[model samples]
Target: MPTPIIIDCDPGHDDAIAILLALAHPGELDIRGITTVGGNQILDKITDNALKILSFVNADIPVAKGAAAPLLGKLVTGEEAHGESGMDGPALPASKFKPVEQGAVEFMLEIIRASEEKITLVPTAPLTNIALLITAYPEVKERIEKISLMGGGLAYGNVTRTAEFNIYVDPEAARIVFESGIPIVMSGLDVTDKAAIFEEEIQELKTRGPVSVMVGELLDFYSIYGKKMGFVGNALHDPCAIAWLLHPELFESEHLYVTVETEGKLTRGMTVADRRKKPDQPANTEVLLGVDREAFIKLLFDSLERLDRQLGSPAGES
Candidate 1:
């Protein structure tokens, strides 16, 4: 049976690809809906981007807008990285998909309650919507299979020396989710940094086919922000979570007690995994620190190819 999942995201370029992967690999996962939150951009833009991406792939999934800001701090968006539109690089057509009337949290509760199996929460953005849903419906806690999130870093950080953008955007929300006692699979910077996209790969994608053309276009738009940030290539951050789900063997992780810092002058949102030499705290999460980059990228490209075909276009190298 395919694992049922709800992707709570902010539709960063990588987030767009992650959704495509989930929808494409029908045998691996069953997507319930997409919940948009404030992070890579403001709530409205991210939600709009999510709907747009689904439409691009001809997916008919429902969308729900999440919190406009974090639970305890002012909302901060990465306009510099994702642009004013959140998914600024591609010149996408107007989205045909529309958001449902209920808010993200409400939609989440209803989906989990109705699903026959425990739903997995894949959050590739700030934890605002996931935290809110968990808090609002404590009864759903035990029903969640696990949470797979993209944030944090065991050694270094992208947003701060010790934090990732998603967590930094909403530290309080992250704290709430981490301490919720649910099972967690954290694919932080430690793993995603390895999932880089080289120029040749993007070019190959462009020539491989039209799906490749779309991917190439997407990456072209995605790479601009990365170059400005002093990165040689763009990392497909969001897809790491989906890739981890598809091929857990490609990644190595440690079971540890993880906590998110909600308050600190320089450490808010930092995922403080107890990597200590000696500690009494029980392990709560499987924090991934390494990944097989070659395998993951292959999985990603293959899945994207599947989606292109399902969306009524030919995809190469499948």
Candidate 2:
């Protein structure tokens, strides 16, 4: 049976690709629903973006709108990287699929409580909704299989000198989830930065089909921020989370006890990973530390091709 999961995201450029990657593999993952959080952009924009992306791929998945702000702080957006609409590359047709009325936290609780099998949570943006779900309804904790997420890095940061954008947007929520005693697989920037598809690959992907062509355009715009960071191409940050869930062997990880710094003045949102050789803190997270970039890129293209086949678009038509 396919592993049931919920994709909680903000529909950032990479987040859109992550959803496409998961949906392309129906046999491997059964996505119960997709819930939007306020991260890359505002709640309304991202919720609509989710619907548009799903419609773009002809998927009929449930989408729920979530928190518009963080638990305790003002919301910080990634408009710098994602652009004003959150997904700012190719023009997407307006989606006929609308989000369900239930809020993200409530929808997640209901799904977890009602599902016969355990459900994994894949969060690719700020963790406010996950924090709210677990806190407001702590009883659902046992039903969650695990949380595979995209945030945090022990190596360095993007928002501040030590914080990534997602965590930095809502560090308090991140701290709560990190301490919630749930098993976690973290696809932090430690490995995500290496999961890049360069210009050559992007050019090749554009010819695959409509979906691949749009993905190529999305990367073209998103790569601007990556270029500012001195990368040859844009990093597939959000897709790294899904990639690890589907193909763990393509990457390497370290079992570490990690926590988000919520109160530090200059270090807030930093993932404090206990990497000491003989430290006594029990490991809590499988932190992805490296990836086979070639294999990662191949997996990405493979997903695009599969989705193209599903959409019935002829090869090399885009």
Candidate 3:
């Protein structure tokens, strides 16, 4: 049987591709639901983007909207990176699918409680929803198999000198999750920055099929932000989380005690990974430190090609 999982995300351009990749591999992943939280944009916009991606893929997974802001801070969006419409570039039609009437926290609770097997969680946005779920229902912790999240950085930060965007957006939520003691696999910048999609690769993807073309367009727009920062291509951030689930061998990780800094003036949101193996700090996170870039990209391209074959022509092409 496929590994049952839930995807909690804010549909940034990369998040859109991650959804497609997850949906493409039904044989490998039985996606139970998609939950949206506020990060790349507001709750409404991100949720709408999630609906749009699911609609484009003709997927039937349930989506539920979660927190609009962090537990204790004002909502901050990465408009400069993702554009005004969190998922810019793709001339996507309006979403036809509707999210579940129940809130995201409730949806998570129901799914976990009802499932006979432990479910994996792939969180590609801020940790708000995951934190809320844990806080509201402490019993559900035992039901989670693992949390593969795209956030944090072991080295330099993307948002600030000491913080990554996702965790920085909601350090409090991240703290709650890190301290909850659930198994965690963090695909932080240490690995994601290496999962870069270059211009030539984008052009090649466009020829693969309609879905690939749409993904190429999304990456094209997403790459602009990275170029400005002197990067060769855009980092496939969210997809790295999913990729870890699909092919753990493609990544090299370290077991460490990771904690989120929610109260540091200069280091708020910084993921303090205890690499030194301090006696008091028990290892809490499997922090991905390296990735085989070639294998990672190949996995993405192959998955997209498979999706293209399965879904037929891209929407509006026929």
Candidate 4:
């Protein structure tokens, strides 16, 4: 049976690709729904972006709008990296699907309570919604199989000198989730930076088909931002989280006691991973530190090709 999962995201370019990758493999992952949170953009735009991406792939999954702001701070968006519209590359057609009236937290509780099997959560954006879900309904934690999230960094930070964007957007929420005692896989920048797709692979993806072309365009736009940050190509940050769930063999991780620094002025969102276990805190997260880049890129391309074949359109037109 496919592992049932829910994707909580902000629909940044990579988040869109992550959703596509998850949908492409129905046999491996059964996506219960997609929940949008405030990151990369505000709640309204990110939710709309999520709907449009799902529509592009002809998925009929449920979508729900989640928390509009963080638990304590004002919302911060990544328009500089993702563009003002959040997903700025491809001219996405208006979404045919509409989000359910139930809010993201409520929907998560409902699904977790109703499902017979444990559900895995892939969060590729700010963790406000997941934190809210846990805080509002603590019992749901037991039903969650694991949380594979894209945020934090052990080496360097993208937002601050020590914080990544998603976690930096809402450190308090991140702290709550990190301390929630649930199983977690942290696909931080340490590994994602290694999963970069350069110009050659981007061009190759464009030639695969319509869906691939769309992915290629998204990556192209994303790569420009990467270049500005001194990277040779775009790092598949959000997709790494989903990719790990699908192909754990392509990655390596270490168990560490990780905590979010919610009070530091300079490192508020920093993930303080106790690799040496000096704090004597019980290990709580599997912090990914390495990836087989060749295998990962191949799997990503193959998944996009499969989806293109299934959809049979460059823009998903039947």
lDDT of 4 by residue, 1-318 (tens): 999999999988999999999998999999999999999988899899999988888899999999989888689899988998998988889999999999999998989999999999999999999999999889889999999999999888998999999999999999999999999999999999999898998988777777898899998888888888788877999989999989999999999999999887888899998767565588999999999999999889889878888776442333
lDDT tens readout by residue for model 3, 1-318: 899999999999989989988987888899999999999998999999999988877787899999999999699899999988898998998888999999999999999999999999999999999999999999999999999999999897899999999999999999999999899999999999988888999988877677888899999899999999999877999999999888999999999999999889999999998778678778999999899999989988888877777687642343
Instruction: Residues 1-318, candidate 2: write the lDDT tens digits.
Output: 999999999999999999999998899999999999999999999999999999998999999999999988688899999999999999999997999989888898889988999999999999999999999888788999999999999989999999999999999999999989899999998999989889988888888888899899999899998888788877899999999989999999999999999889999999999877655678889999999999999899889988888888865875
Candidate 1 residues lying further than 4 Å off, grouped into runs, are 276-280, 316-318
Per-residue CA lDDT of candidate 1, range 1-318, in tens?
999999999987889888887887888899998899988888888898898888887889999998999887688888877778888766888899899999999999999999989999999999989989888888899999999999887777787888899989888888889889899999998888878888888877776645556767788888987888788867888988988888899999899888988778788778888866555577888998888778887887787677667656666533
Clash counts for all predictions: 0, 0, 0, 1
Shift in Å, residue 56, candidate 1: 1.1
Which scores greater on lDDT, model 1 or model 4? 4
**Residue runs of model 3 more than 4 Å from their true location after superposition:** 314-318
Error of 2 at 274 (Å): 0.9
lDDT scores in order: 0.85, 0.92, 0.91, 0.91
Candidates 2 and 4: which is better by TM-score? 2
Q: Which candidate is the best by lDDT?
A: 2
lDDT of 1: 0.85
Worst 10 residues of 3 by lDDT: 309-318
Q: Model 2 segments beyond 4 Å from truth?
A: 277-280
| Decreasing TM-score order of the candidates | 2, 3, 4, 1
